[model samples]
Target: MSQHVLALPSPIDLAAAAFTLPLFSLVLAALIIAGTLFVPRLHNRAGGTASPTAPVTARYRPEHRALGISAIAVILVFAVENIVRGYLLNLSDIVEWWQYATPIFAAVLCLAMTLALIVLKGAHQPERPVVPTTRRTWLSFSPRAVLIGASAAFIALLGTTVAAGLASSSDDRGRFIYLEIPVPNTEIEPLRPWFYGWDFGVPVLICLAALAVVTWATLRRNAMRPYLRPETVTAERLARIQVASGAVSIATAAVLLALGGAFRFIGRSGSLSQLTIGNDDTIYDMVWKYAEFAAVARYLAPALEITGFVLLLFVAIRLLHRPTPEGHGLRPQPSAQPETVR
Candidate 1:
């Protein structure tokens, strides 16, 4: 097999062309504010009735408050780093530092948070006695529901991408190729097959699969009505957090899958073979002049992924430091035995 090389813009140039810090900042800020305001409200509204004797003072424990603040700080730091990196990318000749450090830092933070959650135990409150009731048939917020819905959506998006790739090609041989317009008046050529496979196929599958597995496991482990240990007042809160986090992750996966499909559509719809070249102007002249317009998803998808990751991290930290149960102070202490018998 012969290798066909299409001259394309440099990675730095593409990154600069695709993203700008100011616009990214505005979008990020809006999402953060919306999440801050709405997610908790949604949880509360969906949450069942509160106990009448629940204490009103210091709803959040000291550790919970500290974790919340730390989570917010991490998000702010990431935002600032992105803005600075975006600026540096615009000016610097090499973006190696930003490229290497940003994701590593983010990953480390998330990993550390996960480890902390697993190792650290929260203050345990006595569990209330379970009342015998008729078993419900459906649980909308169950792990099973989330897993099924997310898996279906992911498969649908994958199918859509395959269809779009086929539709975009001029030949019926089921090859995935797209045009590259690096410079005006240049020769028209198909993008490398390996590039397409790596860029379009690999990342989508990995992200979707990883997110699905993690979410399914987390939700299943913390089901709404698990057989609770005697001293676990925060069980309800933890369950709610798990559900909310899974919901957000599933939603994020859906958005990413939709964006992937859109990217494929854009590539397929703008195939060079579909257009006729005249004597004066070549295909490259017509296409490369407007390459930026066509490759919008190249930048948008990563942006969404970053946003999703940050949001998920926030949820994880929130779960790690969830407020202690109000009944923690009221649980009866174990009785002392008299020493006279001894």
Candidate 2:
């Protein structure tokens, strides 16, 4: 079959086009915040006495809601700043060190906020039971799916970055490319598109390592905090875990999405055609032979991103838009049996 060559856009154009995902995400996050606040609360259960855990849920729910909102807000703000910085400074046309560090900074900031929210939620709560009634820990209540998925995504991002860095054949200024193709018996040569972590994975990896430490330490602190009711604390703790987990899941996935998508789109586009060797099957064959991973990444990047986002979104909404117990939907009233506690 004959190869069809197409002209690839400049670095500026490529990066500008790639900004679409972050832009869409920002808008979606804004809508999420608005919906969380403005949408009227709905009730689904019949009248029943509030559980021993109801007050804990009631007290922390708004804080978690704010956390959820703020998680997305951080993404939105960083995204805007990233876009503005790229365009105004014309950084999109060339590689720069700041490009790699900026996203990591955003993720770290989001994680810190989540930890702060957790601290704030437990500040006024009672201490843990002196006599252990249950053996439950943070791990038991944590959202395993989210934690696992985020961990996996982080590993995948690291792998791709390392692979790209190893494969890099040239670094012009700050821009790094996996390889450059030269026309047979000619002076013409072409550069491949950008991939995340190429020639700059060290700083990114360092930042990620710090994030992991912060997350572990904060969750540990959360586990040690007291509960309103030990037996009924599962729901409350799980909700708290979801708050931190959701933020983390979103942040990790967003970084992977932004960086991975940037890599794949540009690489795939460059592979499909070249300016110097238009419609030359040799060029296409060379690109495919050398950068075979792009073929798989084209699909994998988006699929992982969607999976992470959907999973996090489901759990986040579950925690944020909790179903109000029928009796608690309207207002507070003294239970008929005030002394008949759990």
The best candidate in terms of TM-score: 2
Task: List per-candidate RMSD values in Å.
Answer: 12.6, 7.9
- Residues 158-276, candidate 2: write the lDDT tens digits: 77667666655555565454455444444555545454435556666666677676666556656656665544454455445645565556556555644554455435643443342
Q: What is the lDDT of residue 182 in candidate 2?
A: 42
Name the top lDDT candidate.
2
Cα deviation in Å at residue 214, candidate 1? 0.7
Give the alpha-carbon lDDT of every model: 0.40, 0.53
lDDT of 2 at 157: 65
Tens digit per residue, CA lDDT, model 1, 105-191 = 333343334324422322233244433233322232354554455456566546644543443332234334343323334455533
In candidate 1, position 323 carries an lDDT of 38
Off by over 4 Å in 1: 1-196, 224-342
lDDT of 2 at 6: 97
TM-score of each predicted structure versus truth: 0.43, 0.66
